[model samples]
Target: MESPERARLDAFFRHVTEQFPAGAPVTSLIVTHLLSERPAFLRAMSATSAVAAVLPKPRSIDQHTLEAVQSLYPVHDLSRELFADSTRALDYIEETAGGQDLVLADIGGYFAPSLSTLVEKFSGRVLGVVEDTENGHQRYAALDQLRCPVISVARSPLKDCEDHLVGRSIVFSADALVRARGDILTSRNACVLGFGKVGRAIAQTLRAHDLRVTVFDKDPVRRVQAHAHGFRTAATTTEAVRDAELVLCATGNLALRQDDFAALRNGAYLASVTSSEDELELTPLQDLYQRVPVGEQLTRYEITGHYFYVLADGGAVNFVHGAAVGTYIHLVQAEILAATAALSHGRFEPGLHSMPAADRQAIARIWLGHFER
Candidate 1:
């Protein structure tokens, strides 16, 4: 007998297939990280005549999974073959598409010149894209020219899955940090840069761990929100880090630069909760300061005679150190799948778009029904 959750997922997939018929041929080029663990997503794509090629992040590829993916479709590890060489990746995608209607991808496909190239070359053949990351959405929105619809989970008002999932994961990361660092977070002052969804969540998680949390965001509205939430707000990033024993960057944008390192208190642990080194400007920091590796994922930097520790090499602390949020990510993936189906049905216009409210509600309902039980 099919489990209730499995039945619901099957019904959803069937509904999508009915709405977007295979006769129209909705071929897709999916680029993402951690594809192996999400078997349901892969199964849905396999059922569709639309799946053309899958490009997964190299770090996410395991030997067992790589074999499985290769047996189903042409699988390319994006980090190894594509990310470093977008032009080559584009060439591979163009060839694999082979005149089929191409649609849908994650952040790995939507960033930089790659998306522009797909839009230009594929034209009407390109239906839409699904971007889940804030940085990717910002990049796509800034493009002066866009040919297909863009559905962003990051920007969706109705789909609070990202926010909720990130919030839960932040607590996990905090727990791992506390365990590893000998209760440094216990009753200590921590600053969270960027008062966005992820930042606010990190602050809340820290507080739950008995840490005094302060938030810093350039946007006044977010700062006010943080203040209203009873968390202290810092006027500037520099001010936030100066006295903080722990600093977490959650702004999708670069929140800390090499110069900002000078402001951090000695022995302060700097970590990122958004996307990796981008939020903390790791390249410049490494160039400007003497770096000593504490472990595979943590580093110590000496600047101005003060020592500061960087968690996960300034990468996402939860992903690098703590357990993967598998269940939460599966929920987000369902939203992505729904958006892809909606796009295939030609329900959106040629611009950046949010996930349809109806879809968000449905996904949320199903998710809540499963978890609430």
Candidate 2:
């Protein structure tokens, strides 16, 4: 079989530039993708859009530098392929470290700044890890976790962070989490709050699977958009939760105040996709509200006649609980990001990297493709 890298690049050359004339005013193609394990790379991408951004490496190159450089050779088209290979490249890749306690880091889309934060927060706890890119080496000075140093593609103790956090709760293994997702998404009437990026994505994903969706947002335009998209839109977060069987907080705002719980119904599931669950002010809410634990990771918050179930303590439920995102989505997004960044002279840095322009375009294409079908 042709190498994934070769196939991806070949596809890029064959298809990525098909829109423009062979010699149109188009500039370059910037590429970026998810590295599965390394958080640093995603962080780097988030920090600054660079040109030819090698995962885990940093430089002062700017977008103008990319544009002035004539054309961009997007790295994601190749880097994602290379990154996917790194794990299988080493035999001892999955071996665990010295500690019995495991540390799972799910650094989504290795960009720079996010990756740096990963190095700072969890490198010391490294036992074994499944890094999706070569950037993992920058954070770990030694490959001590590799039991058989010479063997590539070996099992590493470092698990994907996404595999650990599920349904706003942490699971010890991927199997347990998978089982949980099977049950969670099957629940009736899930409510998604904060019609922002994460919220919208979650709602769309649920709807794609035929799950009933009701979205809430403070922004009038967003509410209108959600409603227009065939989702039930609520004017207030509290009202959205009132009828929801499950409540997902996707907003970046501090909306889930202690008093907010007072409005929730009994047995409703509450999960968050934002940065912090503490923003829910559970302690103050707990004072007046009574929530009970249901499943291993599920909680039941008793509010008036309703019981609200909270998952992952309101973290990014999809990231925490769901299985690996579909590879097709990842591939499309990575390719688009790479192409766009390259055109603008920015390299795809890893770690909380911004959604690449090409990837965004690709999303539009995918949506159009689906619509046309």
Report the error of model 2 at residue 57, Å: 20
C-alpha lDDT of all candidate models, in order: 0.70, 0.41
**Residue-wise lDDT of candidate 1 within 1-373, one digit each (tens)?**
1377666655655554444344355787777654335445676765654677777654344556567777887775555335336576567666778566777677633344566666676534777788877767777777787778988887665435557567667657655664675645788888988887767777887888888988999999999999999999888888888899888888877889768888899988887765554587677666678998865556789867888888766656666533355445555666677777777678889888887667667766666655555
Clashing pairs in 1: none
Off by over 4 Å in 1: 1-23, 58-67, 79-89, 157-159, 181-183, 321-328, 368-372
lDDT for model 2? 0.41
Candidate 1 vs. true structure, TM-score? 0.86
- C-alpha displacement of 191 in model 1, angstroms? 0.8
Top TM-score: which candidate number? 1
Question: Mind giving the per-residue lDDT tens digits that candidate 2 earns over 12-43?
Answer: 33333344212212221122222332222232
Evaluate candidate 2 by giving its C-alpha RMSD to the native, one decimal: 16.2
Q: What is the lDDT of residue 245 in candidate 1?
A: 89
Give the distance in Å from residue 173's predicted Cα in candidate 2 to where it truly belongs: 14
Worst 10 residues of 1 by lDDT: 15-24
Return the lDDT, model 1, position 9: 58
